[model samples]
Target: MKPHLTLPIAIATALALAACSAAEPPAPAEPPVATETPATPMPADPMPATPANPSVGGAAMDAGKDIVTNASAAPNLSTLVAAVKAADLVATLQGAGPFTVFAPTDDAFAKLPAGTVDGLLKPEMKADLAGLLTYHVVAGNVDAAALTQQIEVGGGSATLTTVQGAILTAMSDGAGGITLTDGKGGTAKVTTADVRQSNGVVHVIDSVLMPK
Candidate 1:
């Protein structure tokens, strides 16, 4: 395999070139603006705090039940339990978000070789930690049924607008499951679904979703 193949997919997703300029060969012209045309469904732009839920919860829900407590109750998520709290996202998790969180269990995070998690938790690394945490949350109330159905139809993909204001592309696994392609194109599989809460739903994944 090529050495570039080893680079994280998140990086690639983040840096994808929007376009490349070509040499100028003609005079610049103003683009056309259409006059009164029927509007059509514009696929979707990730989904930034939809109309149904326009609230932001940066810190008001710390005392409420959150991903940490929920993941903790499940014996298999002990590690994920630690990471969520460490990232200072427990409160955000409990906020009245209607957030669609793609949660990874403890064992899923263990897939990383070593030292990565430790380095990310350093005090100076708060920004990086926050980005990683928010990448797991889609800004609206997206249920599994909605996701799978989106794929089954020819949608082929749906973009999720992360709390960090980043986009994560999700595609179907073709086996009644969904796979999330991180900003860098890294994929995380949904292992469990519909872990409901007052604010939103949680879907357990077998791998951590990283941003590029």
Candidate 2:
């Protein structure tokens, strides 16, 4: 009993040979720790996708967002956005109600007459290029302060009526701005008018409107 301290039998044979040299089989199970994969979500935006408005080959279609959207017109009329897409007239200037476009920028087709905007963007003259572009449209809704008070009480003048019906006058250039005769007289001045659309109004003329 006094020697029972045989060191607890030499520490239980050194803890059974150190648990059989730390059992080498337990390490192979650690390979299950590698996981990372979860990321993908971004895509949704495109309709009339708005880079601007107007359709059909979209040739600068900027007739004041089709007169503010009266229905869908867009003939920013100049030498004609490539003759209104070569006469397709962008779905009849976006059809539906109230149309009043006097637009014409790009320096108003650079004041044509020289090859008249490439001869009305040829192609059998697309119905004379959409009848000289719906003769600069005018089915209704003529704004711009009632066209500058009807061109100052008619002294300056202010008449309109097209859709091919013809009869566009709207003059008044003592400085104020306004001019748009066409029925073969071809004038165009407006040089930027009301430009409100959604029903019609763009008066940004300069020239390029002849139809008689």
Candidate 3:
């Protein structure tokens, strides 16, 4: 009876130990190590660069634009632009040939006699208007530096043949400026020089040049 009782006691103890082992709860699962995601970097602002060309008529001039396109943007050139349109010379001024333009300001156009611009803009006077406007344009891109060099080379004056088939006399104004004498002896001083464009360069003049 005593030996049976001892064996029973041993079996009960073994079962209790097995139950305790099962209740241990997997060592708390190591607390799930938190992996932090890296933060995203922000982008920088995109700023535009400054343009190299100077402003004209209170508007910024872009060197990538052609002559007619640039001239149309200038406030001081509205009269000249209208005259060009009336003369049907927009296509010619916008052409591929590198033209040198002596651009006249609105004040320059105002110096003409009353009704001169209106008269020239008429349909019947298209040929005359075209001829008169072409007098302000030379065949090639003659910048201020080149014109100065030409004047120096020709002993203080240079002759420029216009697209209007007339001769223009370029001379130094004795004060580091250029003066253009038209065929009719009217003189125009270059107020602003070296206004660069895609197709050519322009020198803003205070007076309109005329052909003979």
Candidate 4:
């Protein structure tokens, strides 16, 4: 009797499978996962660059000090220091000038005819020495960049008015340096430049600048 009921039993089993599948609802399609794309990581900011400070007279210059003080600290400028003091121009140079000084080294002073510096340092020659010293100083802060710009604008030579009412000429040395010409037509090369001071800038010259 069991063998005779095989067909009806197979049909009943198939119907039961279909009923179970329909009742389960096919697992609801797994509910699409809301995947959010991760945001790109941002880069960190770069560090600021440091400024360059140049040395003069075998020592670094202090921008916190005035011209007279800074120059007095330089060993190579001893003659210049003495001359400044002898001329009684220390107070003037130390004041709020913003003057550009073409400072000559001791070697530069030596280049003059024998006893020239000694003669200038005499009490009776104080006025003359002051005039000569002032000739090396130009009013206002004239950095190398300013001199370069002026030279470019002035057709390769820039004329600067000095504190002594004399004209000084600045020109490029064709070797990435600067040269200055005084009223006496003497030219001096800037051995060191852009020496910052509280009141102005100092450009160390290899030779003393003489004015007519």
Query: Which lDDT value does model 1 have at 9?
Result: 71
Top-down lDDT ranking: 3, 4, 1, 2
Query: What is the alpha-carbon lDDT for the whole of candidate 2?
Result: 0.66
Cα lDDT of all candidates, in order? 0.72, 0.66, 0.92, 0.91
Query: How does residue 164 of candidate 3 score in lDDT?
Result: 91
Once fitted onto the true fold, the runs of candidate 2 whose alpha carbons sit more than 4 angstroms away are 1-26, 46-96, 103-136, 139-161, 167-181, 193-196, 206-212
TM-score of 4: 0.82
TM-score of each: 0.65, 0.30, 0.75, 0.82
Return the lDDT, model 1, position 193.
69
Worst 10 residues of 4 by lDDT: 49-58
The weakest ten consecutive residues by lDDT in model 1 span: 53-62
Output the TM-score of candidate 1. 0.65
Model 2's TM-score against the true structure: 0.30
Per-residue lDDT of model 4, residues 34-104, tens digit only: 99999999988888864565777778788888998888889999999999999999999999988999999
Q: What is the lDDT of residue 82 in candidate 2?
A: 58
Candidate 1 residue-wise lDDT, 1-212, digit = tens: 67776576756655564222233356778889879878897886685753231111212222235555555566666666566667788887767787888877767777877988888778878778878888888877788888877666746988778898888877888887888888776789987766665677777788988787
State the lDDT of candidate 3 residue by residue for 103-161, as single tens digits: 99999999999999999999999999999999899988899999999999999999999
Distance from true location, Cα of 9 in model 4, Å? 11
Q: Total clashing residue pairs per candidate? A: 5, 7, 0, 0
Which pairs clash in the backbone of model 3? none
Clashing pairs in 2: 67-197, 67-198, 68-197, 68-198, 69-198, 70-198, 70-199
